[model samples]
Target: MAIARPVRALGLAAIMMWCFFLWTIFRPGAGIKGPGDSLANLERDPNLDPTGEPEGHLVHTSDAYLPDANPSARINATLLALVRNEELEGMLQSMRDLERTWNHKFNYPWTFFNDVPFTEEFKRKTQAVTKAKCNYELIPKEHWEVPSWINDDLYKESVKILEEHDIQYADKISYHQMCRWNSGLFYKHPALQNTQYYWRVEPKVHFFCDVDYDVFRYMHDNNKTYGFTINLYDAPYSVPSLWPETIKFLAQHSEYLHDNNARDWVTDKLRRPSHNDQASGYSTCHFWSNFEIGDMTFWRSQAYEDYFNHLDRAGGFFYERWGDAPVHSIALGLFEDSSRIHWFRDIGYQHIPFFNCPNSPKCHGCTTGRFTDGEAWLNMEDCRPNWFKYVGMG
Candidate 1:
């Protein structure tokens, strides 16, 4: 009787082991699904490619314009550029490079904004480059001009001080107007009312890599609020009161700050020497505004509007020459989660002296390692380390 009982126990244990092995092989995420698997199972599988492309498919430069490479769904987006009528040639060069590298296949529409009416020649020449629809809109006078509340005497004195310090564009009132307009009024324009996402394109900038995927769709599906290609320090002399005014706003409305906010990156609190030392306000690190891909809804939100109004009331835009770069950076750093702010490391972009040349196979007409190995000025202003450290990737 004892021997027969032991034999039955051994058989039962073997059967149980075999069942567990089968379960492991056929688990939900094991990549071994039957032909009869449900679509829900396929959607839930993380091992599958998000782009729906077959595994191991190679993407060449010519593949950028392939009809089959287009995304299955597209996000509501546009290529937005605020340009002058005189920059026609430079704008054309930028448009061609972007269309060649990425936009030809998807054919997203372009929206151009000018403080004044666009010239017929400028409109015709730009429209001739691509298959996408083109829009030209004039900036409203109220949106482009200095606010009524700005004290003229204070503003003039500030400009004089900036000039004495040899700050760039200090004596130009139009530059201040442009910075203020870009910071608070661009998204409010009538032309961009229906658009949810915008990729800002500036004249004379270059796109170096072949982008095989839809960036707007990527931003939407991935829940990214802001994307940038370059990071650098802002000129401190240009924004003397920006950080202080930002602090005052934060104090008044503490609830607006995100729980996973990148305050440390902007404040440089983590790298401070001691607790007793005064906290370093805004390390002057900012994302260069020239190459920005962002969701317009964030800028249109109440938090951002209130923040902008506070800064505008403080009169830094005209009083101290506050660039749009630092204003946007400070807002994102305080109000949004750091993870939602993306760095497009694969995109190769250049705006004159600065370059973001990623070491990728898809790039053309640019060399890698220029940010680190090529220029002394770029190295001094590089803010990637601070950003990387904040994100726990350094």
Candidate 2:
């Protein structure tokens, strides 16, 4: 009886130890409760299913994974679009393509701006296309209107000359306003006040690849200031005075230039002999701004503001068809580090008349090697080679 009592006690102890071991392994938040195991951490983990569902099970929820929930996990960015009410169909098409390619997974908010109020139909259709929140904002009049400092007669004469030369949108005042606003004023909008990064989406553009990762987070983590897919030479005739004006600005604010600037990519200084004075001229190479993923703080800086004011006061936006593409490119090439400006070669993008298709497994419905033609002239005009050489990636 004594031996049996001792055996029974030993058996009870063994059972209790076994139960403790099971609790350590299978209790709620047991082995997983360590670094990066908090509820917030699990919610922010892109690889994990936050709903706690079984693997391969789909869970539908109306609530988006708001970046505000865990600010450290995501970037303060938005997909920004400047559109008019009349172009609702084109906007919807762009929304559909982007959603299908990328945004559907991320659910980043869409912020739309217009000089006028967005129509109910425009709002409804755009919101219907995505589960993300949609914000509609009217561009303030002061931001869109022609500055009073501009000479009316001089502007009119310049437009007539550009029209005579068959320049695109030369006679349209609205185009001029758009160019000016996009160049300097877009970042000033109250709607974008809270946003640090923006991916500019234009109407009727194409997104041809599955962007499985978070682009905004990539930009933030990689220290990238500006990202672009297409690079092209700007029309030299359109901005006759832009280069000269940029030279003057550089001379005045030489301190603003970054030590490792990409100025050589935009000029022939490195290509020509050191003694050549004419090599300092602008190459007219620029990033196509129709599709831009940029850090807004770069535009909001005092240096950029001063540069924009200098150009704005020069009246080139109206007197000449000075595009925002060149303006933005020039600023980034001079002020930001070359390494910080990223060429998004993995993304397959297309704006009308051109394609930035990449030879990537993620891309679909596009032919690779379509970025440039075989003609030597076309290839020389392409800024990609120069950019590649500048970045030492070619």
Candidate 3:
């Protein structure tokens, strides 16, 4: 079709304008020297915004939204921490040195909990030794003292029983109190209020190799709520055969009573094959509560509080040399679903009564000839048949 002269001229003008605008906006800008401009100029020139931070970057991107990206994350556990209390001069210094690598490298904070006050020299010196924040706290009066509810008579009876059996540290009421406090209240510290993960450290506990990744972070990240070393010393005979009472509580109260965490810990033949899961009504009782990394909320749960209170009311803490380890392990077994109590086969652990090593270099040293059978590690299995089997006869 033939176009009118004025219309054709207008159309040609419109095309030219469109081409000019596209060239200016879509095409790359040229340098003052030539038609080709360097990307460096985009970065150097603030107006150009070469980084394009608003858009995004390939690496080292902003983590403003990440929970662990800043200080607040330490509480929710996007970033987590571990702290140790060092007592006495000898084991204290050695363990402190071992901690330097883990603390300095990870910048994890360490809080030294002691019943006796830390001296001026110790504080100044320890601060200098660790780049991490070092806090010294005197064990509170509430933590150290035996509550009035504790029958002094029962306490002495427990001590006498231990003496007769020759169990070391049985006579030390302070040690018993320490165990109770560690399991019951250590995380209640104001400084740790925000922390979701914690590693309890005694004075001489040592980490041998160079640990690059933050263990607290790993536990928190992977949902490996509880980690520990040194299994054994979890004899049910050690606690009151309170299974009748405890099992009744579980079946009536919690749905996850015999969950995987409970099953694996109490029923696994690898850990406690002969444990009586059925007697405990398939309860999860085979757990070692000490040397553990765990979910803080797990302890804060109503189940734990009730269990601790019930055990306390029963006077188990005073009536027996009730170590917090067994108590804590039992609680984890009973209360948490199998997904919660995690076994760290790689952690090296040692104690009296011995356990089948999951991944301890001390595996060759599992020579603890005394409590050789899996019964050495107490659980529901010791009381019930076919307890260690994952699947029940049901």
Candidate 4:
């Protein structure tokens, strides 16, 4: 009888253990939702007040979740690059980064233009890395050559003086040709004629964030005409006489100025719009052209075409080595409303000695921390800080 009692007690203990195991496996909100429930239960949460709200917050319900809009319904845009055969490797690195970060999802086509034909190796290597369609086209000679109107003697003298001063790319006539092409001729390229928007990429530029959304879609949806990452002042030595000429053109064409233009951002402390001063001068600050995503329509507009024609006739491109940076800046400041211009805050970009690194905590790929902070170059060139203030975004 005593042995039976002990055996029965042992069996009961085993049964109890088995029941507990089954309970753990199938119990309602037992192991699965305990931790999560504690977080979601406002009444039980320590952060909540007596009203079961998180301190000062009220109870609210959100609308039904919505799926993302079809990304394929994006704007007609292409990623455009102008490069030489020697720059193939550097361009490929940028292409790969862009692909992995954003274009892989969007599959936007890439159009590359070069003065010389792309070598077989350049085409094959670049095509292998990307799934999107790629087109390589040669630039027409007329577009890449010095205009016949420019006086050779004056151009040579100017280049000699700039080279003596050790100015950047001063001795290279090809560099000046490149600036001129970018200023007015690039949008006219037959390969780019079909697209309404272009995101310009240069050799060795870095994109250091996962661009989850379609930038082109944002531009199209918001009606943003121009987008830039870095804004800085041009070296005064590079364009001493350029701004005075711009002032001259603006005075002659006062009808073209927008109602709410970014005039204060471009002009010196001396501009008076009433009399339209010819000597108002420039602040020399320009949005760096190397990293631009803009509507091609903006550049192709009559206002921009007329502006380019006026500057071209002035012969500053060859005579003074005028860069396209200030030319585009001053034109956009006058012709477009400030609201049409956009600063892409999420894009992390680098073009030697300067970067527009994103400050968002969500940014994981950025090597530089913030656009305006910890960089010595911004202080050395005082345009970026002023750009923030001019745009009312400080």
Q: TM-scores of all models?
A: 0.79, 0.78, 0.62, 0.77
In candidate 1, what are the lDDT values of residues 1-394, reduced to their tens digit? 3569888999999999999999878864343123222222222212111222212223323443343546434457999999999999999999999999888867778999998999999999999998788999999999998899999998889889999868799879889999998899999998888889999999999999888777887787778899987888776777767888888999999999998887766875333223112213667778999999999899999999999999998988898888888899999999987777877776779998887776666777876443333233223566655576565321
**Alpha carbon lDDT of each predicted model:** 0.77, 0.77, 0.51, 0.73
For model 3, the local distance difference test gives 0.51
Q: What are the RMSD figures for all models against the true structure?
A: 11.8, 18.7, 21.3, 21.9
Instruction: Give every collision pair in model 1.
Output: none
Off by over 4 Å in 3: 1-86, 90-94, 97-101, 235-237, 242-245, 255-258, 267-290, 346-394
The per-residue C-alpha lDDT of model 1 at residue 136 equals: 96
Instruction: List ranges where model 1 is wrong by over 4 Å.
Output: 1-72, 269-280, 372-379, 392-394
* Of 2 and 3, the candidate ranking higher by TM-score: 2
**Ranked candidates, highest lDDT first:** 1, 2, 4, 3
192-283: candidate 3 lDDT, tens digit per residue = 67768776654434443333345665665556667654444244344444455565566657763644544343433333333344324323
Q: Model 2 over residues 76-192: C-alpha lDDT tens digits? A: 789999999999999888899999988877788899999998989998999999988899999999999999999999999999877776779887889999999999999898878
Candidate order (TM-score): 1, 2, 4, 3
Worst 10 residues of 1 by lDDT: 45-54
Give the per-residue Cα lDDT of candidate 2 at 245.
Answer: 92
